[model samples]
Target: MDKKTHFDFVTSIGLMILSLVMIVDSYRMGVDVGGALYASPGMLPMVLALLLLLTSAMLLKRSIRNGGARQNLAGFVAWFDIFRKSRMAREMMVGALILALYTFVLAPRLPFWMSTSMFMILLMAILKATSLVKNLMITALVVGSIYGVFQMVFHVPLP
Candidate 1:
């Protein structure tokens, strides 16, 4: 199999495994107070697991149907090389990771403006942004805009 097919096969297997874990965890949650599917604590997780299973199955089916036909490992490797050499892609990936970490980990405890400002500043620094004035201005603009939207307009609590 070519690299693309191999990667897809592996991804399908990994998704199937993750789905199994989700299903098991949901099952282990046991019965809820009312013994109703809707009221059960496991309902959401079970639903997510079933969705994951279905998607993974579809991926696997599509991959098998395509077979090892037109995919070329050499071309895929060339594409990977292009991506690896792209500074813009790398910077964007770093920015995304920073945003994800702030959203998933820091935002829960830190104040919204504080965490977002820090994340924006740190991400700009990582991207080797020139002009300290520009960096600070951009950071303030983005962070303040987000804060205003969430806290002032939406009246959402900041954590």
Candidate 2:
């Protein structure tokens, strides 16, 4: 298949996997609360995961119908080569890596606001989207807003 179709196929598979994981985790969170299914803490997450799974399945079917299933080893290799050589693809990969690092590494170790600020600053710096001072100001505003919303409005503790 073409690049777009190949990309869609890959993305669908990833989404399916992610949705499955979410489904499992949400299920483990307990699907029923006080005899009420909708009252469960996991209800919304489970519903969202199911929706994502359904959409991913549809995408997968469409990709396969559009010749994605005909892609062979050589074609896959060629696609990877093209992806590796593209500047946009490289930037996207870097951005994804940074997000993963922030989620899995930094968030677990640091306070919520501090980790979020660091993530925003690092991401903007790596993307060269703005000057350091501007990035810091933007990060501060965004994180402060998040903190205020969670702590004051929602009465929720951030971690």
Most lDDT-accurate candidate:
2
Worst 10 residues of 1 by lDDT: 67-76
lDDT of 1 by residue, 42-115 (tens): 88998999999999888777776766423533445666787778998888888889989998988887887788
Enumerate residue pairs that collide in model 1.
Answer: 110-159
RMSD values for the candidates in order, in angstroms, are 5.9, 7.7
lDDT of each: 0.78, 0.86
lDDT of 2 by residue, 1-159 (tens): 567777788788899999999999888777434346777788899999999999999998988887756583346668999889999999999999999989899999999988899899989998999999999999999999999998989999886
* RMSD (Cα, Å) of model 1: 5.9
lDDT of 1 at 118: 84
Residue 8: error of model 2 in Å? Answer: 7.9
Model 2 poorest ten-residue lDDT run: 68-77
